[model samples]
Target: MLQHLIDQDEGLRMVPTDRNELTTAVGQLNEELRGLPEEADPARTRVLTRWIGIGQMCLGNHDEARTVLRQSLDLAAALGNTRAVVATGLNLGDAHRYAGDVQGADALYRSALNTARSHHPELVDFALQHTGKNLMERGDLASAKAHLQEALRLRITKGDAGLVESTQAALARVELLIGRADASAADGAVPRQWSGEWTSWLQSRTTAQTPARWAEDFPALRDAVRGLNAHQRVYPRHLRDQPFPAELIAAMAAEAEKAVAADGYLHNGKWNAPVGDAASRFAGQVDLAAVVARSTGLEVEQPHTAVYIAYLEEGQFLDFHVDEFGFGEANLILCLQHERPTAAPSVSTTVFITADGCLECDLAAGDCVVFDGALTPHGRTPLTAGESITLISLGFRARDQASRTVTNLPPVPR
Candidate 1:
């Protein structure tokens, strides 16, 4: 009854930004904690303590959150609740991260990861995801991407749409920073003559109203729709995967290293340095726009002036975000180089938010993943410790934009 009252009073949500709500939630949580059986039930006390700490966090009281979460962690540890331990660790890590202690946050996340890995592998993704997010904030893009990718791969395997969407958004943000795709649209500016099918599709999906398949001929699309009907929204569909010859991959990697070395990286944001010409030498021969159009059923022509390439060493990652629809209708990504033939290799993965589900697909050195940039949400995971990723992105204007011409303003320097 007390718990129900607390939930009702607090709206079963996070601490509200409104001063009255915050105070009320905190006070109610405190009252509940006081009433919890102290010595008779350690487990219950730990859970309530954790909730209070989370409430404190929602109110931006990191110091109080840390104290309370630490105590909860201790109790959970004593009770042998490994999952709770992991959860508490994550909460505490967030408190530290928000308090501007990156190292402390990393340590806590790593500790949680280790604990999860040993006793509860299913919980490893949580630790990795939080760590990746922290790394992104600390300017450690490579590590951030790597961790985020690991977490995303796990979430994909688990078929969790909500987690997958959130992670994809993080990865996408990282890519935009590196690719400088937002150069044309800064300051949250929307295009004057822009219309995206995503919003309408999102609305339809919300009401469980299935729409016509853009690519009815593709089994992947059909299967995705079937899964959507079954309430599964994290489907994996690979339109194509053809392995490039080892020699070709080597040559491409060599050119990429040289070009990035010569041109340097353009930093428009936090995580990535944009390389507009990662594979200019092979641009004419390899146009995957047609493949994208066929698979996604969107007319994407008029390739952007230059392909955006990102050269990421270990520890770098892209955050999740949707592509700028105003700049291009769709995005065609080609993985130029990835993974080493060593004993233990790390593969790079891309997470996508489809109309009905989430797609987490791994990319090899020669593979390509194409989707509607404006409509679907997507992002890439970080590279392995010793491995690096050199990939190129080609954006295509919508078919409707062919007849209409406007002076495209370049992205501003941040």
Candidate 2:
């Protein structure tokens, strides 16, 4: 009857139902366990404990889940139940993952993988799936993709529709991000010149923001980035040189003019700008999108919002503000034209407020800047009378944090 109940619970586990049913089930199982002799059936006890742990996890009681799952795993190991050990180990890993202990979860998953590979080939996919998910959350996209791809390949041969579909879906997500990261290199958009100073700066900045748990993996990641084709290598966050070829820039400028003429400028209490049809099209291009993603060191999705051409006229200025989330994490601004009356030392500078201090960037025609605009406070100095500037603004969202809404974030105070 207890085994029967366990089977029933497994079948109903994923069904959307009242939590009270699960709570009652847990209580009944515990009561039954207490009635059994200490040695009556260790196997049954292990199974019961494992199910209870799973139930606790479902209830969001991760601490309780971990304790019980650990006990179950020990019992399974003692009984030489390789299958049970692999299964329970995965559950324990899941408990850790849910509790935000990714490192702990990864260790358990790796152990499960080894055990399953040696004795339970059928269970290998489960181990791979969990490990892949854990690594992806930890920002190790390359490893995650490889694991998921392998799992998907195995699942397809198993001929289980549900399992195959689940793995496929996970693989698809990993591929999307991998494709984004690989786009720039594949498109031959890597900058012609890369400075050692810039590489050092990028390495420091990337390392500083990376989670401490990922410290050990940084060297591997750095080497992998370096190993990529010139077109495949990720670019530095801030580049004084243009990513696009001179010919491409000229063509893009022409398109910008046409787009502005068609869409006209719209004032949104921020600046006068026209819908950047040309910029949007170019941004959506695989090469440009890849460059944007690589430059930010983030796997990004195609821009959902339209790009814009900010047509700043004399006396026009932009207030310091961070771009909205989802649509503005990484901002790329291309200066199509900057005309100063009499060319009197141009004061049309772009300013970014950083922890270090204020960074004043003076952009000339054809120059561009790419930065984390979603979190960084930035703005433009007012244009002097008879001064004018044209800029194409493009934004991309980190794939992991993609959202359709353009959150109206408040401006940062100077």
Candidate 3:
């Protein structure tokens, strides 16, 4: 019931895939399992354990998952459940691979393949497919090709289009790996040809973003996250060098005071991703957030802005990225008003400037930093692990929108 409540509550409806949620959900499942009969229902227990293990693995808790899934595999073996064992072994292989025990992964895959042979042809083929994948990762191209080919033949004979297509894709990937792997081994430091091509391509594409360009295009922040998977943080860096002003801090506090009880949909008075049921918060807080937006000439793009709230002792941060694509010409971090009385009276933006500035700006409660968002996708060096720090942002499309009736400091001397 507790898990259900969290899942159902809109306020608690964060991304299910996030590590926090995964860990929480697994904890809940463990509690429920403890309450069950010692014998428990075998099938139910297996299913729950598998999913919980998968969730744990997702959160980088491989050791915990390994123990749980090993138990699950043992149960499967007791029931002669070949398919279940195969699935468990496959995921276990992944855990081992990620944990850097490649040899262990190879052995497990081989074991699963052997176990699956006595089962149906489909099961056998499935096991072989995974084994081939493992072999490919180990650079055993001949064995990988042989296993994958056998799996492909079995799928074709069984007239299973899905399996056939999947095996074929795997085969193609293996061939590609072999081609690259061989070259990688020979070159000792990346193939010179590919490196040269990539370098030239990067040179052609590289162009630093200017602060003024942020004012020219109103890029949405939500759109930027979709393509920036490799980036570990997301906050503006260019503005961290500047000192936070005293007057701006006062204005920000005043505004945060006005935000009390003003939240509706998107503005949950808490941190939330932009989406339906939160859209109202996005548009409603615009007036308050715009103050910061215009000051920095940066727009907030969480799909739903008003719904995005950062609370005291809380902050929202995006980890590193090039912030490429048309997400925005630049990114800005704005200091918002923290109206509620707290240990920290005012809010400030913190930008870790890395260039000649080597400067760490206080990002005073109201002062904001503006920087090249597109060229250097920003992110907090260390994403706050506790609840996200509360923040207000405006994803600006036009510079006119950035300080709409709001005043910004003079641009640093060019």
Candidate 4:
């Protein structure tokens, strides 16, 4: 009788004549799931749990959705139901991501991708979509684009209209971001040789190299990370009596100033002027990128994707947010200049609100700060009047190994 009632309710709610009626039908479905016998088959129970979890997610009850989906995933895995496991895992990953657990979502999606590859090759596209979406949200645009592009190709081969449409939309957005970054860059700011598909250039460097090899290739970078704080590291002009090349710094600053003019001031409560490709000339001319990579233990041979400048004027400040890109994880921030020089020289102070209380530092001109901006939330308090700061950012994907679990999954069977 209860099953019949749920079926009847679902039929009525299919079109959802009204919000209240649809919600009531969902409540009926929930009650039916709850009324199932304690001795019910685990697989059957998991099916119900998965449905309930998906419904909860659609209803915007993310916390309940995750709880329900986790139960489904656990039961499905124990039963060795590869199909159910992949389904529940993907749903649960989305739930966790919606709840702001990005790291957890990435892990879950990676595991799902692994399971799908080994047991259900047909589900590879589904798993890739979820993984790519999570990375995109986390600001790993380069990785996100790769995953989405692959998923789109698979979906095309499968001839799935719905999947193709959605994946294309995602791929387009990634392209748009790349396009914006390119358009915003100063003309002649980057050489034509450096102008090819930026993400593809990055992927080309994903050779099978161990961290030890990276350490050997870039010893200075390894040393820098070793002395890093939990969330950040500072590299003083170790050359002592010598600071960064003023000529190089000046060239970067000029490009940044021009970019700001072209792009206009970006304001989201706080004003910021992003100078695209501002540091390209310097990074391209000298071994600055190698030094930056070495400083962060990244591969010395791999090129950084983006190098830009940020002009933060007085009273303007950046809010706390983690980097969404892989390159953002090991960001190289160099202070170019600051107005209203103090006795100690004006600086843009950063406050890293970490799990271990707060760590504050004054990032002064000519000094470089290398830190995993993705793992922690760091921001600046508003600068005082007549105070301004220019910072050059070198963003590279040095931690490609973290993605191997998903990307290196066995290829889908023909």
Candidate 5:
């Protein structure tokens, strides 16, 4: 009778829509276990306890779930049941995560992953997925991406469409958090060939009194000196408009808000912001590269560079710099939210350096700008005090050069 109840509970867990039924079933199972003999099968007892904990978690009883899961884990370990141990450990980790104990959750996940890797290879993907999620919540996006990528490979080989989709969704979230894995070269370092030239230009600009003086002295460094009025040539076309659907814009805004509320931003010295989760998922649903191609008249390849949303706060400023060769050939920026003190006189602007002079673009919510970020130098002016802005940045490679490796080329300054 106990074994029959255990089997029924397991089947109920597989169909989560019957939550009330499952909860009632778990209660009956617990009552049956209490009436069982002390000499009941230890393995069955371990599985029963783990399932009950999982049911508790489903009902949002994290504290109760953790306590029961620990008991099940101890029993599994004592019985030398590796599979049960791993499964129970993962559930315990989820309980910790649900209770906001990220550190505790990560420790349990790592233990489960290590044990699965050593004993139960077939179950490794499950451990990997949980560990990846725990790391993502801790803001270790690169590490999270690595784990999810491995889990994805394993899931694909297992040929489970549902499992594959779950891992893919987790990976997409990580990608949104930390742009593309290859968006920039390793460590954002400048290439050897351009380092000396970049250093020289920096020194000259530092000492030069005015833009004209720098332009006159370094005529050979025309490409390096930004915002210099040295030429009267026409620059590349830069279009600004509202092109995204209203619903999509609203979804992206909601994602940004949720990310901020959850403290999901990665605090690198460059910028601390959470890229929009909806934006990444939307990319999968739509052919964004083709949209870029139609708008810019450039043949764009699929799988464009990372799609990310950047949140800029007061006193934050982006220095003028050209993008890397392929990834930034065509760049898109969409303004999601912008707020400033009404009394403040200065307006923050996205500035592009062109042959004519500085072209300043003031964007509001729903506004977007498309430009050649790879060849042109661009940046944002410092936000005035009490000001903030949220912008989603998308990158694409021109079809002609999409196949080229980014490492082989020089790095673009940030």
Candidate 6:
């Protein structure tokens, strides 16, 4: 409940901004804590403690949060509790991160990850996801990739939807930085000729929606899409591997290469523009419909929402984490891969939005992919060498999410 309150008010808009209000809120939680059964449930107590910590943290009571989180972890240890350990670690690590103690935060997270391996692997996945995020911020690319990759693997294996979306977000950033297609959109409308029917017709023949043989009629697109599916296939460890159709893989690789080679795609540097890119379709009008439809495959059920974009470059990557609580209804990322040579990798990942497909398909020379921003926990993977135009758009799904999220914005706008 306190976390929900925090989600609703980062600036303490709901709670009085005075120290008195902070004191009262903590005091109320304390009263409940004193009554919490000593042996009834250490796990529950730990959970409650984490919440108390969060309420304190956002209310600018960092010291209080640390104390609460520490107590929470200690109680869990007494109960031989792994969940409490993970929860308390996360809470403490978050406090450390917020307090500018990155190293300390990282240590706590690493410890949590170790504990997770034995006691709570699921929680470990989350720990790695968070640690991966911290590494990204520290510019520790290789470690970031490993941690994020592990998190992605664990999330997918367990079908943990929340972490999956978050992992996808992180992977996209990694691709933008290293495997960037680096394609700059030609100064033209999203190609008046493109349509989802064309894409669907093309995509259906390749994945679960359709079969690969449909291309017998249009061999070029057929070959391209077919080849794409094959090339990107993660060959199974067992024998009789599903031969990632060589042609299919090559075709997508060619497309990724072409996309990256396009001008306007950054080659190997940084560029800055106004954080607000005028909506090409409507002035003072945000087409969140387009974003939602494209990213999530879900139609907008409401009106009166706005959308906007934020761009990043080679050295740019966001922390691995959930989108801020109440920033927008959903977040959409349209990546313009920086144009590059033919042998490079194009970035993509599976997503976890209950709305649409579970993955962000590989973007081609000119593909605009979207995913549920707020519902999906996401971040970026560090890049080795490349640039990208990541079009980040947000629409308000619920007023509270929009308001609660966005404590930190990508550096470009600031």
> What TM-score, computed on C-alpha atoms, does each candidate reach?
0.41, 0.44, 0.39, 0.43, 0.50, 0.38
Task: Choose 1 or 3, whichever is better by TM-score.
Answer: 1
What lDDT is reached at residue 305 by model 6? 35
Question: What stretches of model 5 exceed 4 Å from their correct place?
Answer: 1-238, 260-270, 274-276, 307-312, 402-414
Report the candidate with higher lDDT, 1 versus 6.
1
lDDT of 1 by residue, 10-123 (tens): 111223446566667668878878876646688877887888887777666767888999999999989888899998999888877765455567789989999999999998
**TM-score for predicted model 1 compared with the true structure:** 0.41
The residue-by-residue lDDT of candidate 5 on 1-414, one tens digit each, is 222222212211223346677678779869876877999998878877888887777666766788889999999999988898898899899878766555568789989999999999999999999888888877688898899999999999999998898888888778876764345445344442353444344443432213334335444344444432221112344455646676777787777666556655543212434443366555655676766676777776654444334545666666555555444567877777778789998767777655554567888877767777654556677787888777777776666654333354334333
What are the RMSD figures for all models against the true structure?
21.8, 21.1, 17.3, 21.0, 12.1, 21.3
4 or 5, greater by lDDT: 5
Model 4 TM-score (2 dp): 0.43
For every model in order, what is the number of clashing pairs? 27, 2, 52, 7, 0, 42
lDDT values, one for every candidate: 0.60, 0.63, 0.50, 0.59, 0.66, 0.48
Better of 1 and 3 by lDDT: 1
Q: Which stretches of candidate 3 lie over 4 Å from their true place?
A: 1-28, 185-414
Please give the distance, in angstroms, between residue 175's alpha carbon in candidate 1 and its true position after superposition.
2.0
In candidate 6, which residue ranges exceed 4 Å CA deviation? 1-28, 34-44, 173-414
Error of 4 at 411 (Å): 55
For residue 152, what is the lDDT in candidate 5? 94
Highest lDDT: which candidate? 5
Q: Which candidate, 2 or 3, has the higher lDDT?
A: 2
Which stretches in model 4 have alpha-carbon errors above 4 Å? Answer: 1-22, 181-414
Candidate 6 global lDDT: 0.48
- Candidate 2 backbone collisions, by pair: 185-231, 185-232
Sorted by lDDT, highest first, which candidate order results? 5, 2, 1, 4, 3, 6
